[model samples]
Target: MPRTPRSRSLRWADVAAWRLRRHHLRGPLTAPEPWQAVKDVSAALCGLHAQVMSSAEQAVAARTRLPDAGAAVREALWERRALVKTWAMRGTLHLLPAHELHLYVAALRDDRRQMGDRLLAQQGLTPGDVAVVLEALPTALGEDRLTREALAERLTAVTHDRTIGEKVRSGWGVLLKPAARRGLLCFGPNDGRNVTFCAPRYRLGADDERAERSTPTDPAQALGAVLRRYLHAYGPASPDDFARWWGTGTPEVRAALSALGDAVTATDIEGHRSWALRDDVADMAPAPTGDGPLVRLLPAFDPYIVGPSRQLVSLLPHPALRSKVSRTAGWISPVLILDGMIGGVWKAQRRVRHTEVEIEAFVPLSSGVRRRIAEEAEGLLAPGDGHGITVRFA
Candidate 1:
């Protein structure tokens, strides 16, 4: 007989402890090789928020010992083809494991359709027009890397609609998004100031032939796989949180959860209903209370900040501080997290000789906290970029 899964009621502290463990912040930080660490963290989070290259680099560096993390990430993308940059969850640019691209695309298939419809409607385009672009994308990209402008030109030549060319070159990502969602397009090596795109399969070359054969073909299973990963890393979360993260409807999120069956168990999180992987419930045992406050200098759009959990926001010292971390116009500033709560917002300006970091605390920080913040800033600097690091509280 199958046993009924046990229910757990969680307080705020439990969530914080789970987050620390899941995010790899509480454990020893002996770092892995740069590329391996990037792959490990990306897979752990399912993907890394990568709208800004610098933010993505810092996010990875926070977990690993890559001094020049940005260059290392680029090596993974361009040289090794180990990571892929494309439009992913919430229709934002993220760095995902290259081989798993199909799974993400399959999971978001419906959401991408809805997004496509809205974007096309705004542009006064029909589904047929999007279909045309989708058809021409693979052939247009062929085996060669093409700048956005060059690809737009080629797409224009194929569609024979000059307006399509204009839209592609507008840099708004409307026309190209569908291709990325369909796994037909991804970043190519940049061409100076211009960004380029190519078919991911072409980018992977012969390696993709083997991957495609082994990749799961079922979309429902793919959706379930992505949700399981989400719950594993960011679980004890509501369907709304999952919906917000994926930019999908609640129906889809709920359906995916249902498909997981016994794998998911219900929980009460601060009086609200949440779900988590059954095994994780045991791991959420309250952490020791004696340790001093933990501090992290998280970069903009770090997963720890960008994850769609209002519960995390409630951990802020004050409600007003929310705006500082979660800014207007999709600008999430770098943050100072002290003891699992948002302590302040921070910024770093790097020069050839040194990096200057300025922190604005919502609450006064002690000298020990300030010293810890300075140490965190030092880690962000490249080797021999000078021992000079300035951290001033504003």
Candidate 2:
């Protein structure tokens, strides 16, 4: 029988530092930025470090601090070649910096490319037909937005293809994934729903055009680079977590972990084995949330909610927790971050000019914490902010 992995207790403070500093907040937040800057900075505040947070919390935080906070985030967003999204890393979304996009997307593309061949075979799409569909995308999208229907129409015209729908989906994946790999296109602001496309402003560093051109686009190389970066950023995690986040086979996760070698250290979480940066244990601490303070109204998908494992949430058990966070739904209900862990979930919606938020607690709140939660909710209920606050029990 295979030996079971060991469980190591982790310092909650270290977990907080990993979630706040290294992963999100890549650079100091800035202002007067482009859409790209806004997207990237929002990502930093929300989760460039981890996808545990929902996109809704991201929007709240982006708008919460007004000009100063929003501007800083936008400034950081535009400083990259492309921001990586829709590839690996929980198979959700992320806004990677330009210099790093290539490595991140390349790994994901390799995984997808393998699936593409299988999908293509199942769909009976000829290579020539697929190529034709792919070629038409850049022009179809042009420098303008390409809605779903518009892209479908353009693909049909270019390839004279019968399966316009499937082709559009697959071919767009081919184009966007490579663009993500090549440092060209990145996530734009949400067009009310999902992300739209925009060009990236690349920082080529000191490398000349030739040197930049010489950089490899091979997917395996990208995967290797990504493995290194993941361990570097979120070390002391288990191969299971990495596999879940990256959507790779166990063999692949193990191989990558093995390659990391001394750069990482293995420890047990409770009884389960996990990994961490070799020196990270000694170098980090949990953020000081001030003495006797416990209540915080974390936006939906707040980093504190989704970034760490359930074990980190001392008040609740993992399998017993009920709030579902699904990627396809595109809706993230806000939650109460009590003592730096999820206490329950909430949501805010507009009634004409007024905004109302509904709060549901998994456990009864203390009178003091409840008051603080109301205060935090008030941030979302400011006058002229298009909302008001209300709490209800589940």
What's each prediction's clash count? Answer: 0, 29
The candidate that wins on TM-score is 1
Tens-place lDDT per residue, model 1, 61-172, is 8877577788778877788788889988888999998777878887766565346567778876667767888998877778889998899899888878887777778646
lDDT of 1: 0.78
Against the hidden reference, what TM-scores do the models get? Answer: 0.92, 0.68
Q: What is the lDDT of residue 34 in candidate 1?
A: 68
| lDDT for 134 (candidate 1) | 91
Provide the lowest-lDDT 10-residue window in model 2: 23-32
List, residue by residue over 1-394, the lDDT tens digit for candidate 2.
1132443466554554554454333123334444444454534432353243234334434343342333434444434433334333544555455445545555665564334556556656555554564466555555654555555676566666658556656554543444444344456555666556644432334432344354456765655556555555555566666665566676777776676566666665445466776666555555665644455565555433444333333334353554343234543456665544456777767577556667777667777777777776665344434455665455
Evaluate all candidate structures by whole-model CA lDDT and list the values in order: 0.78, 0.52
* Regions more than 4 Å wrong, model 2: 1-64, 67-93, 113-132, 135-145, 160-218, 231-234, 284-290, 301-318, 323-333, 380-387, 391-394
